[model samples]
Target: MPATEFQQSSSSSSSSSSPSFGFSILSRRRDQVHSHSMESPPAGLENELEAFQRQVADRFHDLSAADSGELLSIPWLRKLLDAFLCCHEEFRAILFNNQPYLNKPPLERQISDFFERSVKALDVCNAIRDGIEQMRQWQKPLEIVLCALDNQRSIGEGQIRRAKKALIDLTIGMLDEKESSTALAHRNRSFGRNNLHKEHKSLGHFRSLSWSVSRNWSAARQLQAISNNLVAPRSNEILSTNGLNLAVFTMSYVLLFVMWALVAAIPCQDRGLQTHFAISKQFLWAGPILSLHERILEESKKRARRNACGLLKEIYEIEQCARHLNELVDNTQLPLPEEKERELRITVEEAGNVCKSLKDGLDPLERQVREVFRRIVRNRTQGLDSTGGGD
Candidate 1:
């Protein structure tokens, strides 16, 4: 499908009446089920399912609308996470409202598979949270560089030397992180630490299981595990389950894409985007998701970006600014020339801007990642409970 068609479809769905129309349809159908009927008509139920798919497509359409400057940026990533959360909630509602079909033949097997995939994703979230902490460590050296060169009374040899040291530290840190797959294992951090001690005995296994996947765990392999056996529902399966199987398939793909995007944007161990899955364009949401996937892959293939620790725009900017400043400092003599000093200050100001962007953005981004982790845990717990403890 062409991109423009996706945009047109999304635009039509975003009209003011669309939301109310969807709500009224669902509300009336739900009322019928609650009052006079034990099961909604298949046609009415299908309308609800179609609305759910459109909403997923609309959310991703908005995400893919980001310009080049915004793509893979911190703010853009947060929006991506927000979109996933929204879709997840809506998918959960669909399952809740159609509890009868959940434990039935095809959907029962499909949902169990989804929950297993979601469990694998929890490890990704933990690794991603650790990756966020890794980014924070990089910030320390970056801040040192900013402090040394920013708003100085005069650009002098001592300040230049100090900033150079910080730049070298930042350089080494990024390089070590990129090259060493096991480096993060030594730190031993997880999202479950604070809550692990407080949970009841029955929940202990789940809490630990969610938080403490092995240190040798590979994000690349974890992603592959999630993608394993994931395929679109066949027509017969969809017809048999009142389309709930299709909903499970959609949520599974969304979960996989969101995790893949997180690994791409953050500095995680064994970061790889090569996990293979294809979505036919028959699904409305496939266009934007596949567009985004291709765009991010193209970004990773760029000469300057290919070897970087992460593909975050801010990370790229910081590395560029730091490289320029490092080169300037290396060739300058004590009693720096006017031209060199002026060039140095300009580079420092540019680095400062990147730093400012990180300073303002990282906290909120981490919080969003944390929220994603917690929500996945809650959703998995609820799902397993609903299924009478999934296999």
Candidate 2:
């Protein structure tokens, strides 16, 4: 071989025989680039996530079943939901970006856990979204009922005013007739006893007219009283029923938003080392990782499928009650009938029951979600540690 060619060939052979130093240097450079790419995203995301979390927490922390006014504010509610969804999307992106490392042995469990979290979060979002849609659906009916009540009130007030004015005019006419009859009686007494019988007859006529006027006035007053009583209760019933429905709607959102927050927080924990080992193991994988992944998927699927149908049915019942109230308010009747009033009360009670049942369902669901995710994180950490030590 030529001297220069020989030297070059020997150097190439040496490089091939031991490539660790070169590989390590190259890996360090790659890691630096990867970390740089990761830096801005995680830092920015952390602040975004924390702010959202704090807002959600603050908004709901003190809220209770009674705080429907604040809870039912649509603009506030929409903003709250938007914050939750934004957090979810950001978390999803972070997970997806890490997907290149997820499909293998030990880290597969953690990935499965993440997938589990994502699915649960999505389910909660759907429930909240459904409830919000239902709330929106009530808007038109609510407006219709309010307008109808206002129009009816205006018309009723005008009628009452007219009735009072008629009563006043009748009383004045009777008073004038009474004064003229008294004057005639005095004149007849002065003129002589011959006109005494005529004066007595005229006085009798005036007395009869006064009695009739009194009866008419009393009847009018009674009717006005009845109308007032009727209107007061019906208005109260409609208002109370609608308020309960709103409370139920607000409660659903609160529950789901809380769940979403929890789900968002889970994947924010450290998983990179576990993921690396897992992906590396994929090349020659074996044992518990596969089983763990399956278990995670199955458990998550099972948990997510826990149906809220009962709660949904109750929500529908409240919706029906809302419709009923709207119809009642739109009626020309000042007060709803006794039977209808009983029914209104019943509907209100049923709504309260449904809310209690929904709360009962939510508590268990929350517990189950927390437990499942906890198990997942525990398993992922333990599995990765054991696998690493074994290797």
Candidate 3:
């Protein structure tokens, strides 16, 4: 054994007899567990768990605060080292003697076993870190999906509002023919003979408006058959001649009357189209405009339902993944085995030392290689010069 190993073993033997050699906050906690109830009280479980976590964190902090080498060279650590050395020495002795291979100490086998196990554990741990990184990356996808769903829901709501407004505008425009005709009459009178072309154009517009109202009036008679379906079967009374249907019918006649008045007020004479204009105005403006509103509402609702379902499903998936990740965080425990933790720290330091030693060794080897190369080049140059002089 090396002098340092011998000294470590001697010192460890002296310290191992002390009661506090491997005692820690965790050990005290274990004692508390046994001293108290067999089972922890349900009410205090959270507090106890929190305290234990804090203790572990504080202990690890203390370990990190100490001198790196001194932390590794503690009494308990030296004891472990001496134990390994003793087993190794015994195993070597058995091999040197003519002992059967089966007679090897269990400690030697355990050390060999731990070497492979430790490497496997490190590989698995690295893979776990990679898996964790992959899981973390998925969190962003979930967030993006949730955000997209919210955007779609907002857009759907806006579209419903837009469709509703369009229905309202269509209804109100159909109802405003009287006001439009009065405005047209005032404008035409104000612009009189100088704007005869404008008056003619206004007359054409009235003719077109009358034709449209006439078409709508005919369509309204056909809609009477489906009015109950358009409004609601239970509210069949609402589509009566005395109800909303009568109001819309009156608005249609009013629009036709305005059209006729605008046609009469115009100074421009029609070219034998008065009969056609009268026939057109007879059917103008009287239909169940509610059907248009209902159709628009139905279409909007369909689109909204589709978007809402898709958004809800994606939101559910996001919530599921978030909850799963949270549960994993809540359940996972990373224990701090002081002996193994110390050993790993020392092992890492030793590996670093070995790497430094290799670099130091390479420096000398590089110098020696450079010196040899220089000597060879100098000799070759001297030989060449000698040959040239001789020549």
Compose the digit string of candidate 1's lDDT tens values, residues 1-391.
Answer: 2111122333435443543222223334345535532444455676667778778888997998899999999999999999998989988888778776677787788899999998898888888877776667677888998888888878677887688667655655565334432332222122123322232232222123232446567889999999999988775455556667777888899999999999998877788899875988766788789999999999999998988778999989977887787778764687877887788888888888888888899899888888888888888777777777645
Which TM-score value belongs to model 1?
A: 0.82
Off by over 4 Å in 1: 1-43, 176-213
lDDT of 2 by residue, 267-330 (tens): 1111011111111111111112233233323333443222111112333343454445434333
Tens-digit lDDT string for candidate 3 (76-100): 2222223323322332332233222
Return the clash pairs for model 3, or none.
213-284, 213-285, 214-283, 214-284
> Which candidate gets the maximum TM-score versus the true structure?
1
Model 1: residue 24 alpha-carbon error in angstroms: 19
Worst 10 residues of 1 by lDDT: 183-192
| RMSD in order of candidates | 10.1, 31.6, 44.4
* C-alpha-based local distance difference test score of model 3: 0.27
If ranked by lDDT, best first, what sequence of candidates would result? 1, 2, 3
Q: Pick the winner on lDDT between candidates 2 and 3.
A: 2
